[model samples]
Target: MPSSSPSAGFRSGLTASLPITLGYLPIAFSFGVAATRAGLGAAEAVFLSLVMYAGASQFLALALIGTGAPLAVSAVTLIAMNLRHVLYGPALLKQAGADARKKHAWAWAFGLTDEVFGTTLGVLARGQHRFSERFMFGIGLGAYASWVMGTALGAFAGGGALEGFPTLDAALGFMLPALFLALLLSVLRRAQLPLIAVAIGTTALVSWLVSPVAGIFSGMVAGAAIGMIRAPRATKGNTA
Candidate 1:
């Protein structure tokens, strides 16, 4: 049985975050290496991890900077890339419901990265443990720390550190997405299949026709629309 005690909750959350921390390390290291190779100093690379903290977007930022894109343009692009994050807090809190206790949400919510949100939601949906802000804190702290540490180490390692490990370099690209997909699958339900399919199709189509960024944004919008349409039907069926 899961304990509701604060200490237990924190410990459990920290334990649960181990997998995510592991996943983040190599990816963060990759980002750090990439950033440095693009001419950023180790401190600057680590600073990006500290403030931005966004996984893919951090890489995107490096690309934009490397290309000498205007600061305004880079800012807008990064914001657009991360707009999905705005919905994460509400989605999470809604799933947690009114009783989940969010007195510290303002702080812990900053750590609700894609992996963190998925892991938290999966745990909550599975009813493995009662919601605890302390748990959220623990999970967030573990992941954040690993990401920062990984960035620091990688930045110091220099860009050529992974040049000899072609296989590992290729594998890192898909690791985060694979982890997120697995987390989503853990909480998958039949009712969500259509939404997923639609989202995938929309994303693929837009990416082929336009740009990857457009594809991602369109897919999110399409999925949200589908989910909204299905909500009433799901609610009605449950009440029937």
Candidate 2:
């Protein structure tokens, strides 16, 4: 099938994003439940997913909010957590390029996340799918819709649904981590092992010695610095 056709592109993107959609359901649901349990109103929980659109950040925000963290602290925490995403935009923009980077680039930028980034990168890198706004929308919208639905359900239900299911309540915290792990493993590149190692080591060491928030930011900075230092300089006729 020609990936340029709107219908074909959307369908292909949707099909490719099914697993990510499924994976997001439970995690987002948990976020909703956690948000509500943390004293946020149902609308607030849903709005978090609607506006923030960042899964882990949503959870962290709710946690920070619940704990009475000041606005500045909450903002700083989220910024630290998402420092890694700074590296994703340039690469994705380069790959998707003109195909999806015209009038819709701003909207597309809002939809970029770890899973979406990985899926887009994998497809583009393999040249299996043509990049298009419709295709990217299909993938982003599917995941976004699923996440919103899950959030609404969990926000409304709260602990009521899991009252007797203690085991299920306990497992909610695990879902997001598992999802992130799966995405990370899928996107792992052999050539990036050294960078990955440095990031992980820094994260662990700083987390133990300082704070997890500091560790996350420090880890990404350390890894990025190492990557730049080890990067091969641009040469004649070489795009890399």
Candidate 3:
């Protein structure tokens, strides 16, 4: 296929993110409601959704805030929670074209939310290596639009709805972990992947017994260590 213009690529990227927007609407609405209950004003709730955009981290932070956790504690926890994004860069680099690399890297960095990453990766895997910027933008803009609208609705209406529907809130809280588990399983199809998963699980178990922040960091470190140790060695015998 011929190369696409920047605008077209952006549009394509945005359009490709449509499925993500659908999923994010409800999730973002839940976030808006949670943020409101956590003492954030409607405007602040909307702002957080737009700026942070990290669904799991934002939800966790809002939960902490509602519990009267210190700002530092919440901030640290959110950072720890998002450490997994660091692993996504190298994987994406392999798929993006030279012209799209810089812009895509930026988008991947900023739009590293779970749904966007999944959708973009699927698109790249399908041989649509040089997607229009419009595609990416469409997804981002669609998601952003849904999030803001959901947050506004949730903030304004969530409290009254919650009074009669307690189960809804609890269910919404469970979505993030469930989504992460699904994503983990998708990537853990090979034997080599299990070692890293085991390391992460072990670290998290240890951390839960001690400190949340320490546990998350320890899990990441453990995963990285296992991946490095398992990497194939380059020997003279194997050199061409």
Which predicted model would earn the best TM-score?
Answer: 1
For residues 1-240, could you state the per-residue lDDT of candidate 3 as single tens digits?
Answer: 534776666677666656666567667887777787778888888888778878767878777878899888888878878887776655555445453455555663676665666566566655554644455566667767777787777887655556676787678666656655654554443544645566679677977798765676677667656655664542111111
Candidate 1 achieves a global lDDT of 0.86
Predictions in order: lDDT:
0.86, 0.78, 0.66
Top candidate on lDDT is 1
RMSD of 2: 3.6
Candidate 2: the clashing residue pairs are none
Q: Write the per-residue lDDT of candidate 2 for residues 128-168, one digit (tens) a residue.
A: 78788778888888888988999998999884667788887
Which of 1 and 2 is ahead in lDDT?
1
Model 1 C-alpha lDDT per residue in residues 1-240, reported as the tens digit of each score: 656898988998898799899899999999889989999999999999999999889999989999999999999999988888887788777777654778899899889998898898888777776678988998999999999999998899999989999999999878888897899788777777777789999999999999888898899789778878887765222201
Q: What is candidate 3's TM-score against the reference?
A: 0.70
For model 1, the stretches where C-alpha displacement exceeds 4 angstroms are 231-240
Badly placed stretches (over 4 Å) of model 3 are: 1-8, 63-77, 80-83, 95-100, 103-108, 125-136, 166-171, 185-188, 231-240
lDDT value, candidate 3, whole model: 0.66
